[model samples]
Target: MPIGILTTDTGKLVEIRETITLNSDAFSNSFHEDLQFHFNNERIPERVVHAKGGGAFGYFEVTHDVSKFTKADVLNGVGKKTEVFVRFSSATEQLGGNDAARDIKGLSVKFYTKEGNWDLLCLSTPVFFFKDPIHFPSFFHAMKRNPKTNLIDFSMRWDFVTKQPESLNGFLYLLSDYGIPNGYRKMDAFAIHTFEINNKHGDKYFVRFNFRTEQGEEALTSAEARAQDPDYYNKDLYNAIEKKNYPIWKLEMDVMTLNDIKRVDYDPFDVTRLWKKGTYTTVPIGCLVLNKNPDNFFRTVELSAGNPGNLVPGIPGPLDNLFRSRRMMYRQTQVHRLKVNHNRIRINEPLYWKVYNRDGRPPVRENMKDAPNYYPNSYNGPVPYIDPARPKERFTIYERNAVDLEPAAYFYNHYLCDEGQRQRLVNNTAQSLVPVSPYLQQRALRLLSLTDPQLGIRVAECLEEALETPTPAPHAIKIPRHPYEGNKHYVHL
Candidate 1:
């Protein structure tokens, strides 16, 4: 067989000598086209959050019969397997940031089910930083770099944490050893929002999804994580898959009936708080096994989009304000970044879909061919399927203005049971707080004290010990004093 000639993006053959310019003219179309093509579209917009991630192809097999709880085909029959693509990411890290950094890990699984694509966007922790979606921007902004200095400022982080006391429970988890997981394979994932699922009888149940790692939970200490490779998590996942040591997670659900929701003392839909233990029964639904690695990172991983709004029958989208906001925000962000036809992308496309949405972006494919794009048409446009099992009742949620500290208090006292775990939490919290300003540190300490006095005391003692040793500043850049520091005639400017 003979080798084919190199061609431009337009498929025009190129001459051997056309690759270089003639004399000093540099007017070759082939050379310019190649250079322009490479230069013009070499990069795509980075994700605003969860920019750094690794993805793998897998299958979720239903190991237990969950048909009694819901009518979802994905969780119905035992031994049923559904193709899945799982992406693990760092919530706050940029594209090239360290995977082992002490940050929230994002675990989103796109299940290519028989009906359509169902995305379960999850986080490493069972609780989130804040409840209301209004604080979403501020929470992420504080977690990210400072605007002026363009650095991770501890004062900025602590300031937000102190002001929003509801964030204490989340911060407690983040400041614990669990914050730095050994790798993505060893960590659990939780759908923090409480979703409502219905049975064939239209019986509704409020449930929380948890994917517990079958590999057993493991974590890296602050020192151990700092010494590992920056892409340790990605490398670990890829290598494990390549070696055929597939990682697996058992899918479980904590279910509460409508009556149980009314009997609960705390808000069931609160993302910042966890349901009290024993209040709901945990049911093992299935197991997810990652058996294959993505062939191309950019195509299979980078371009993949997961939204909480993607749901099949049985499971209805959560009505929580944060979840509702995310349902709109995720799709819009993907549209702005990956275009409106992002779902048309190979990795994100559903196993079966027939929507009336047509045209607007490049990968519109057939654009639903000649079918009508509008509903209620005589030409037989795609119509919504009404599931008889779907719940129709509307429930009222009472709004509360009070700040609850019991969750954090429960986490600190009950969850962090052992002395070693408690000490590690104190050390981790102190390590981050040491760089914060004195006032902000005091405020943080006050917040922690409200959760548990011993937690506050231990952290303060660690800070005191750290201050006694007086380490050098993180950066050596010195600011120039103002020219009119002591001048009485200086203007207000």
Candidate 2:
């Protein structure tokens, strides 16, 4: 094969010496047009959260018929396959951060169905920090580095957790062994917010989706995670795909009918709480298999966008407040980061789409080729297809102002029943809490005590053993008033 000539971005062949100027006087088009232009625009804005991630290309196969629950074509026919792109990320880590950090993992899947793209955004934990979206900013701020010190402050995290009892469930999950997975292949993903699905008969059902790892659950201890490579999970996933050892997850759902919803004692729409174990039926949906890795990590994985609001026909948008807030937040963030025409990016583009949205940025391919951009026009333009099976009425949610800890209590007393697991949880919690102030630590212990006295005692013991100096006496420990204590309707459990 003949060697190709080095050229500028505009395709002008360049001599070797033209790449560099002899003195500062000479102008080199090859250096300016090729090297400088590419270097100046190589990076985009980093995500505020979930910045460290790896993605892959694969397909989702429907293993079972779910037409009765959701008329979504991707889940309707058995053996049907839809091309998919999945991005696995750490929740609070910034760009170039350690992949093995102890944090909530983000598992976002984008299904390229014939109808359009469907984005399912999920986290590693079954429950979230809080139900109300109002607390989102504060919660993230607590998890992030402190503004003053520009360092991760455990005191801030413990303070937030101790004040907002609703965060206990997710806080426990984070401090437990589940916090750090061995790798992305061994982790499970949960769509924490409950979604509404309708069928061809207009039968509505409340559902929570889970992607259980087929490789079985495996996690890394704190020491092991700290010792591992910075890009441990990303490398593990990529190497596994390259070696044809594909990672697979079984898609399942805990489904609840309208009657079941009314019969339940707890609020089903709360993202902070989990649906009771025996209250809902768990049904197998399908399997997600990732067999191919991205050829270009930046173009394919980094550029990919997944938003929860990208729903197909059968599966309507979730009505929960958290989901409602996320629908706007994700789109707005993507627009700010990737621009208005982000959907046109090759990795995020759907199989088929027609809309009145026209040019705003570059890569607006063809701009729909001068088609009728305005709706209600005399020309033959695309029209909306109304589905008769779609539900017309919105699902109603009764509001409550209570901080329920039964979920966390149940998790500790029942789920962490094993002595070894409980001990590990205590040790993990104590290790993180050791750096926090004594007042914040005492408040955290009080919060844990509200969940389970034995768990709190064990963690307190662990903390004392880890600390060199003696901790403040129980009588001397003065906890400040909780932020929500003044609320008349706020019930702390």
Candidate 3:
């Protein structure tokens, strides 16, 4: 039989040209060596976060038949086989860290549906920290180790938290038993956003997704979490699969009508709060079974890509600012981490990728060989996914009219819904700062005051009772060198 090799010269499929070679020739070794050298340099880039993750091959079968809710083809067909790559991650920091750390878990899945790579992004908790987009940089800085100290400072972390008490709700979940789960198998996943479901008729409904584990949620205590090895969660997951105790999660979605949104007391679009489940029932979607594991870790796990941007036909997502940010950021990261061919990577590749994007990093299938690289080409390149039956679904975008951009906006600020978010931040932050120098405590007090006056007073009074001596350089330390800045400008300092 002749060797079957790809022929890219033709617009149509063709076999490789046959060549004759002497098997005994020593020059053949030289040819093989040169080819191996090029092959060795073929590895791709890695993702910054969600870097360490595990995935499996599975199908997202729609049991609810939400076609009336969305034009998304994936959710329309019952028992449809949409090739999916689901990533489970640690939300607090990088993927290199242990699975059982005190952080929110991330659940991102790429569904290779007929519409496109429909990405479903969510978190372990329903709410998030901070609402104003401005705090993102500051919050991320506090989460990381101090540049000079190279250590995770509890003081630094709490310092930012106490200052932005709005993050209290998310922190509540972070500090709870749920924060450090045993493994991916036992953690719950939440979409954490109010999205829209658009049908062929263009009718829209507010929706949220929840993935509850069939195995039940079990978390480790703080002491036990710290005592065990960092890979405890990873090991637990791998072992469970190895033992054939295959784990599954029931996919549930809470949906509300436009009428419900208008009637609700608070903003459902808030990332920090969950729509009351009783107010809106979760219709069963389908089961997510993690049966197969990857053979190669880094290629499949580390460099894999996921974003909330990838949406399918019937499942239309909400139009939230954070959700939009995730979509663009994730795409940009994919370009850097996995190269322009990030989407083409085995793990990120869609089962039936019918689109205009072609030619990047690695060229599989003649790199759409000889086809018109650009759209409107005469050659048979991929075409975009559009319903032959109807128009696309769109949601209303609010650019801030009445609502204050705090509290309900993020995980930390929970005053809008859950009872304990703000108070926890106040107490936890006050206690942490209570032991610090008086000068630092006062600065901290002022920051908390910015959130709410009562919060600041409570924190300051708590510090006063714990009364550490004022540092000798109190005035000098508080005052900065050079010209005074804007709002924080206090020449008095």
Candidate 4:
């Protein structure tokens, strides 16, 4: 049998050239055109956040029934297994950045169910830096490298966190030993935001999703993490899956009713605050086991885009400000990076479906054929799902305090039971703030002091030791022109 001949993008075969020369004529060949196309279009824009990542194919088995909470078919019965692709990433870095850096780790999962794709986009930490979505850009910008010097600016970060005050909870976690996980498998994951679930009877409940690592939580110290390979976490996950030692995470839910929201001291919808375990019953619904590694990392892992908005029926999200912003941003970013027809990509696409979307750049599937693309046509068109019988869901969120430093202070003083861990947190935070302007340093210290007076004084002492001088008095410093400006260098003894 003859091998298949190569063709151009338009499927035109090349004829034998009578006279071939290594000149301008060589560029006319479709082969050359194909090569140029491939070369120019090899890379897509990396994710705005969670850029450095590793992922695997997995199965999430519903071990326990939660039919009363959600009408989703995947969780309706025990022993049911849904195919999933899970991606673990560092939240604040580019593609080539270190995976084990002291940053929040993104844990996103795409479940390919018969109904549609359901994504549970989560983070390693339970709470986030800010509760409002409007501050999203500013927060990221602060965490990112400085524009002028192209270096990580600790002062910019400290300025933003100190000013916001609400970010203390997350700042505390990010500075603790838990900030750097031993590997993806050793880390627990949280939805970080509340979501709503509906039952067959149309009953609704707000819940926070938690995925506890079966491997047990383990983290590396700053020195220990820096000593290992930057890609240590990625290698660990890949190697473990290759050896059939699959990593497992148990799916747990903290259920809260409408009445429970009023009972809580903090805003239930605030991503910056966590709901205590005692406030709601902990129920285990399923377990995820990653048993297969991606054959091509770039294709299967890098190209996969998971969004919280890609939810199936029965699993709907709340009206949380951050959640709404994320839903919009996720769609926009994916479209910008992967093109309008991004969902058609193999890794991102569902098993089978016919949607109204059509005729975009490099569409992979059928162009909807002769079906009526427009909705509300008498000639037969898909109709939106509506259930009037469902009870109306309503709730209220009052002005919760963001400036309260109690959480961070409490975590530092009581949560870190080990004196060594508490000392490490203080040292890490102080070292990070060393390069910042004294004004910003004092501002951050003031916020920390609100958390605990002793904690603040200790951090101040550590900052003084690192700077080899006293922290500048807050009222004496002059403001800079640029809003986010910082000191270049700090004097050392």
Model 3 scores a TM of 0.74
Ten residues in a row with the worst lDDT in model 3?
A: 11-20
C-alpha TM-score for every candidate: 0.93, 0.93, 0.74, 0.88
Q: Give candidate 2's TM-score.
A: 0.93
Worst 10 residues of 4 by lDDT: 15-24
Using TM-score, rank the candidates from best to worst.
1, 2, 4, 3
Show pairs that collide, candidate 4. Answer: none
Error of 2 at 176 (Å): 0.4
Model 4, range 1-493, lDDT digits (tens) per residue? 8588766778887555513336557666776777778999999888888899999999999999898888888777899999999999999888899988999998999999987899999888888988778899999999989999989999889989988888989989999988999999999999988888888888888889999999989999999988988889999999999999999999998998877866987667778777765688777899999999999998889889898898877887766777887899999998898888888889988976877777878765877777788876877556776865355766545545546666676678777779999888999999898998879988988888877888889888997888887667678777768855674666899
Distance from true location, Cα of 421 in model 1, Å: 1.4
Show model 2 residue runs off by greater than 4 Å. Answer: 1-4, 23-26, 469-493
Per-structure clash totals for the candidates: 0, 0, 19, 0
Residue 105 of model 3, lDDT score: 78
Per-residue lDDT of 139 in model 1: 93
**Selected candidate, larger lDDT, 2 vs 4:** 2
lDDT of predicted model 3: 0.67
Better of 1 and 4 by TM-score: 1
Off by over 4 Å in 1: 1-5, 21-25, 472-493
